[model samples]
Target: SMICMNHLKVGHYINFGLARGLGSIAYATTAFSLGLLVDKINPSLLVLFFVVGMVLLLVDLYTIEEIAINSDAKTDTHISVFKFIKTYRFYFVILLGFGITFGASAMLSTYLINIVKSLGGTTSFYGIAVFAMAASELPFMAITHTLLKHFKSEQLFVVAGIMYLVRNLLICLAPNLPILILGMLSQGASYGLFTATITYYVSDHIDRKHEMMGQTMISMMSTGLGSFMGNVMGGLLQDCFGLSIMLIAGLIMTLIGSLILVVFSLKQLKTHAS
Candidate 1:
């Protein structure tokens, strides 16, 4: 879904934005139709659909120019992940920051419904909050590359942090349904910015020979370690303290992580100038 963004003439962020926005529309349409069709459709036919989809994806993959052009045909006999990490400590540090940021985001996502309910939101309002966040991604993603042209990726990360800060604060203190939903708008500015750009940044900084490995490490950081920690820590904090305090904790972590990235970005700029 993401790697092919590197191949677009329109630019990675723009390509990703269009891809995700259209994907969201298709997903929503498919989900709604699936809901309606589930009762009438035979279970075995669903498996057939899944197999056909996989086959189509495989065929599509073979047609992508980037896959043909960018991939190595020769297999590596002795690839060492640890040696790569040792050599690219700088990239790892930035990835560490990404992990923390994503961890906090996961915390927010994990408990959003509970926070909404605490603010006196009904089931309908909860649905609205979720829908608004998802729906908002389309337009924001459409403009993400435009925003990137005006700001550094790290600067955009800071913007994402600020949005997240606003979101967590509002969720922590919101007294009514509307305010809580308003906080949900930050989803577009936060994840819509960071998630779309992180891969591009990694690709730019890492050597082409190890590009895929670097991306795998990033995936582990953001989704594997970060998500796991977020789920456990978020749940524990919510259980021990409350949703409000858990969000506050997440806010603090996010700020620290963003600051780390900002420092790294500035350092890179300085090094480049010299």
Candidate 2:
């Protein structure tokens, strides 16, 4: 088992992340279904079901971690949470990305679920819709991999960011479920491309010793900090400005992300030419 773990490729991290996208889709699908179910189910039964699901999830994670330790021959570092914060400013930016992306995405979630539900989706249908999202990744990922062979990764990152900027702006006022799904689908390119490209870039340019740390840096941005910022900002903005404004606010942030990437990317291109 330990030998198999050591045989894993570096790019497995990206694939591992992709695999978790389905988990997210399923989690959100169940949550939305449960939300819709609250009106239909007895309150006590609903609460009992919720508690059982959470407990099972915790148990599952614990079991998995035990297996990981056994198979991977690694131990947890008992580092203080605050020490991670004290590490660097880029990590803070990573955190900011997590918070903003999650916050904004959450604001859109209710709207998205409602849109799908409106478009003849039942609870079971919601699961299918979520599955569709999870499934869309494979094709887009293949195209991204092909593009990587022909283009500088920074350029592709900027391209993905641009597509997201356009997709979300239009999504804010999407007139139907089809359009909403189209916008949501941009995540396939936006998050997917930026992440895969960043991972490859870091692994290719950095020394083998630091590659893992560089990926950890990306994980901090994409999941750790990005999730916090996205969820929080989405909630606050939705509370303050309503759904339309909340969507627009998020659209603006993605646009800014694109702009920042463009600026840095152009500089890199110029440096390479010289």
Candidate 3:
């Protein structure tokens, strides 16, 4: 559906805008739902959120109407859920990426509030932190859109690595509100820049027909997989490693991601030129 809009000759701009808007709305809706569940349920906040997430998964599976890619009503009518997924290596890349990014993110997010309180933060401070973190995304997003015109996935990936490292490094050094806020601001760059660049990269690399699936896969990683991991691990790490250790671990993972990107970018360029 997303790719179909991407390839349209006319109405392209309108279609793309609507598709992105709907995606944003879906995200906003989910965030709102989670907030409401936590606020109203209070004592069973965790259970409420778990059930809500499950409900969302059910909706995704059964609610969204799907049309076969190349439907031939007479004979080419057989298809399975896994059919499209089984055919592409890029699909798996997206899945793995989603796993690493999302899982790690969940662990981090889960601990972030607690960690702040441990470091002398108040409830209002947590709210301030969340707002600051979100506010930082806009500038980085604007920067990405501008740079993407001249750079490629490879460069953006490298920069994202550096940003993540910087954020984690700052956390390890200064576990205070201001520095933490700075680290989170760096997170906006890591999240927005990496995602935007990688999506465009996948769109460019994957076969035209599967671009939308690739896009969806990326979204699933950052939101579904990332959120899950961030919450789970975030709590665990806060209990186990403490804030410093979490920062070190996150820094290492991001560094590894950066190195992999660098190697891949060089290889890709050489392959393309030859």
- Where is model 3 more than 4 Å wrong at Cα? 1-11, 14-102, 143-145, 239-244
Error of 3 at 97 (Å): 5.4
Q: Model-by-model lDDT, in order?
A: 0.70, 0.57, 0.58
lDDT of each residue in 1-274, candidate 3, tens digit only: 3543344422333333234334534554555556666777674777866788799889876964453344224544333326656766443543454356445444555566765777799766666666555555555654554586787666676667566567655654555778877876776666656665665566556665556666676767667765766666656775887776675665565555555545555565567679
What digit string (tens of lDDT, one per residue) describes model 2 on residues 223-246? 666556666677776578765666
Query: lDDT for model 1, on a 0 to 1 scale?
Result: 0.70
Looking at candidate 1, the ten consecutive residues that score lowest on lDDT are 5-14
lDDT of 1 by residue, 1-274 (tens): 3356456523432466657766665654554555456668765766776889899999988986563335544666344778778878767777787788778878877787787777766655665676676766677676766777787776676666567667666665678877877777777777666666666666566666676777788788888988998889999998898776787888887777777766786676668779
Error of 2 at 174 (Å): 0.7
Global CA lDDT computed for model 2: 0.57
* Pairs in clash, predicted candidate 1: none
TM agreement with the true structure for every prediction: 0.77, 0.63, 0.65
* Candidates 1 and 3 compared by lDDT, better number: 1
Regarding lDDT, does 2 or 3 come out ahead? Answer: 3
**Candidate 3: clashing residue pairs, number:** 12
